[model samples]
Structures are given as structure tokens and as C-alpha cells.
Target: MNKRFIKGTMAALVSMLATNAFAATEVTVYTAFESDILAKYKNAFEKTNPDIEINWVRDSTGIMTAKLLAEKNNPQAEVVWGLAGSSMALLKEEGILKTYSPKGLDELRSELNDPQSTQAWYGNDAFFNAICFNEIVAQQQNLPKPTSWEDLTKPVYKGHIAMPNPASSGTGYMQVSAWLQSMGDNQGWAYMKDLHSNIAHYTHSGSKPCVQAGMGEVAIGISMASRGAKLKTQGAPLDVITPAGIGWESEAVGIVKVSDAAKRVVDWSISKEANELYVEMYPVVGHKDVEASVANFPNVQQKMAKMDFARMGNERADVLKTWSDKFDGKSEAK
Candidate 1:
């Protein structure tokens, strides 16, 4: 072979490769998924669909919702992969989400997705609220382990409890909504008033409270059960406590109206394989066939509160406003 001919062929191949790389569909995804698992999810999706690539924009659920609303006029995200269902409902109300029923929609529990004639989003997995009690800190403070939600409000727990701020965290909002539904509106607010006195401070992210507790920064943290379980697995001297009735929220995915690539991403999101991956980290996945037994995590079926998710979504604005008026001033910095 002629050297010149070989060099020309190589140049042509390089140019073709560059063109193909540029032609690959890039989907911009917004998510409130935990930072530790974001890369794994992305890599798995890309591995299955090598023709499509994901560009993630991540933040806490509250922040992501506000940003999406802000960008209503000119949307930037192609899809929303891991945000609370309540947040997605709010986006649906704003007329931002594109209606899509993914391939495995029927396999999911009907209650997990939007029930309207035109579905706006589909659930992937659920996260439940739990108490993370640092064994070392509790022992040092001479505090007994709390087994119930009411137990945290006792005088002995005062100034030793850390919780997430509702205005900035989905887990916080779900807990507040669950309390109101389970305890009656009036009694729930009253309970919070008492609970507030015991709270040392409220953190910005749902996972932070548990992480702080695991580090012995606080004796107890009212946060996501998954975070507590993960911390405990990492050898944090913490006890993952699931109260009698626990607040929980589903994490869902939705497509924006813009871009053809969005549908491809949405389709992949609801696949059985995707649900299997979700269950590995979240346990409570949408697909009925998928089940996981994560260490230190409670059985969701036995512990989940009887929640009206739609009602909670509808009343979110009023609930957040009331909560902010009562407790926002007490929140610690992010």
C-alpha cells in the first residue's frame, strides 16, 4: 500500500468519527438524584443507548423545581430524570411537561404515574423518611434511642436534632405533608410547633441531615432512610430508625416539550433494566417485578404512611408558605 494513500484513508476515518461523535443525540437531564449514584445511572443508560448521551444538571428537588419554573419561557432541560413526583406535578400544572407513556408503564403500579388523560410523568422509585440516630453521640449525651416521631419532641432531644428545611428539600416537604394528612391539619401544625423547639437547625439537602448525624455532628437526623442506610454501611455509628408510619415520596421522570432526543431518554428511563438499577439503590421501585433488600433500610410496605400524593401536590404552595412563615427563620445555612 502507498504511504500517501494510507495517510489519506486514516484522515478520512478520523473526520468520519468526529462527525459521528457530533451527531450523537445529547439529552440535557435535570435531576435531584444523590450525587454518589448519578454517574452510575448515567453510565448505565449510555451503555444501553450508545447513540444518545446524557448531560446532567443536578440540585436539590426544591431548587430544581424553582429553576424549571424560572425557565418556563425558554426551557433548557430535555428531560427530568430523578425529581419528586410533587415537583413534577407542579411542573405539569405549569404546562411545562410533555405527555409520554413509556414502554413499561403498564408494569408499574397505576398510582405511581400521573392519572390524567394525558400523563405528564412516570415514577421510578420511592424514598421514605427515617430517623438517623448516632449511637456514639446518643450514648455521650445519655439519650435513649427514639423509636417514634413523637419521641423526638421530648425535652431530652432538644437542641440535639437536625432536620431538612422543607423549602429546600423534597424529603422535608413530604414529611410535612404526611404529618398533616396523618395527624389532621391542626394537630400536625401543633406538633411541628413543639418539634421546632427541639430542632437545633434545619439543613438544605435531604441527605445532609443523615450525613451530619453519621459524622456525630448531631445526635439525631430526620432525613431519607436510604441516606441513613448508606451511611451505616460505610461504618457510621448510626441506627436507622423507621417510625410506625413514615412519610414517603416517589422520584419520577418526565420529558420536556423540546427536542426529539427527549423521547429516547424517557423511553430508556422506564425500561425494566432501569427499574432494576433503581431498586439497587432505592429498593422501592415502580416496577412490581423489581425488589431489593438494602441493608439497614426498612420495608416500605410496612412503614409507609397512607398519603394522598395528588392532594399534597395541589396544596404544596399553601403548605410551603405556612411552613416558611413558621420555621424558615430558624433554618441554618446550606
Candidate 2:
């Protein structure tokens, strides 16, 4: 009855579909954020920003850093989100990252922001190292659960501990960096040598060590406290132990010199909504008003060693090389 009208409507529909597809922005983000939470944040952000899409490129922190560095001239990522703050600082020093402050940057803790506002990278949350002890395994082997960094070096723990390699894992570098900062260089290097004897293997991913311990693959995992807590909550016979002073680092976000559409994601990165999501895994977040709601979250404020991101960034290459020379023998396949 109305063949011409029907044809016109079909054409209009196709044209509208094409317009919307072209209009929507696809932002590429390279991140070392945990695999489990990637879907959560992506879904949440897209829900709020219907026209902006997130395409995540995920890897361990150190690997992601190297990838970004390798792609310096022809950047593939529009934004670098959830990489280590020190790594972001390093990128800023390399002139790889652009300077664009997000809308809510002032609401975050000033210390978590780049000391120079021109760098334009900011932390979202802090994660600290802890001992993930498989109590069952420890009891089976008659080994004591370690409560301090020094305790892992005892003879009983030899070849029963798993560690993250600082060369490939952000958590690993943070732990190594913190030790050096807190214990003095001479003592820190000496301490690592002692602990090196006990390590069963070093993992590329920070969370793998704890998962290995939870599975009874290793008795102890030197990893993030939140990881230990997550494993225990899943009914693993694991004890999440936080020592008196542990190394810690913040996960940060920065915009690459790409499309202006990337700024929307960076803006949402520091928002209260995003900070709330961060607290789902981390107890410490950059936003002062956002309280952590994680069940049985460790008290890490007093335990964190004083960190200088600038120093950590400057010394990263040297520290990683030395650590690799000393401990890379135990590392698992990349």
C-alpha cells in the first residue's frame, strides 16, 4: 500500500545506524588492572557515558610499561589507566604522556597527584604487599607462618615461597622499591639476597603468587594484601598477613597524546564513582571522601613506607636490572 514510504524509512534507518556508529568514540586504554575488575569498570563507565566505548589492553604492570615505552613514537593506547604511579611518572619524564588534568583532579589527595600539575597523571588507589600464607600447607610442612619480611628468610621457608619479579610486575617493583627506601640500600639488597633463598619461583603477575599459595602450590606468597583477602574469602585456608612496614604503590591513570575523547575516561577515572569501585579491591583510594568498604580490609596507613615516586621513577631501570641480575633465575616463563 505504501511501498515508497517503507523504502524511505528503511534507508533512513540504515543512515541513522551509520551515523551513530561513526559518532561513538572508541578509546583504547592500556592497563594492568586485575582481569576480574576490568569488565566491571568498563561496563560501569559505558553505562554512564553511552557514546564512549572502552577497549582495554591488559597486561602486568611492568609489561604494560615496556609496551608503552616501545610504542612511544606510534602510541596504540589512547590512555594508560591503572598502571603504577611510578611508571606513569617515568612516562611523563619520557614525554610520552600528555598533560591534561581531569575535572575532579582537585578532589583527590594532593600527594597522589603528580607533584607537578603539568605531568597530569594521578593515582586512583594504593595496594600494599603482604604475606599470603597457606596455613594448611605450613602446618603440613611444620613451617611457621611468616608475619614480617625478615621472617621469610628463615631456613624453614626455603624453596617454599613464591614471589613476583620486579622486572615484570608492578607489585614486585613497589615491594623492592619500598624496601630500598625504608631499610637503606645496603640492608635492602642484603635482605633480598637472604629472602631469595626461600623463593620457590617468581611470577610475572603479582596475584599469581597468592593464587598459587591458595591452591597449595606454594606455602607462602609475597603479594598484595587485597589478593590474600580475596583468596581467603573464597574459602582457601589462607592467612592474609600484613607486616609492620610493607612496600606499597598506587595504581594511576594518565592520558596519552591522542584523541580528546580520551579525556572523558580520564575524568571519570578520578570521580567518586570510580574511587568507590577501586575500594572494592583496594582499601586506600585517592579520593578523600570515598571510604573503603571491603570486608576485613587491612589497615595499611601506618604500614606504608614513605614513597618518593620521583625517585622510584628515576631509579626504576637501574633497580630492575640489578634485581633481574640477582633474582631472575627463579622467574617463571613469561
Off by over 4 Å in 2: 1-22, 117-119, 134-146, 155-160, 200-205, 215-219, 258-260, 330-334
lDDT of 1 by residue, 84-160 (tens): 88878888888889887777678886666776778989889887999999999999999999988899889999999
Query: Candidate 1 deviates by what RMSD?
Result: 4.2
TM-score for model 1?
0.81
User: Candidate 2 on 63-125: residue-level lDDT in tens?
Assistant: 898999999999899999998888888888888889987888769987667888575699898
Clashes of each: 0, 0
Please identify model 1 stretches exceeding 4 Å from their true place.
1-22, 34-43, 115-117, 135-144, 215-217, 258-261, 310-314
lDDT of 2: 0.87
Colliding residue pairs in candidate 1: none
Error of 2 at 166 (Å): 2.6
Error of 2 at 55 (Å): 4.0
Overall local distance difference test of candidate 1:
0.87
Return model 2's CA RMSD, one decimal. Answer: 3.9
How close is every model to the real structure, measured as TM-score? 0.81, 0.81
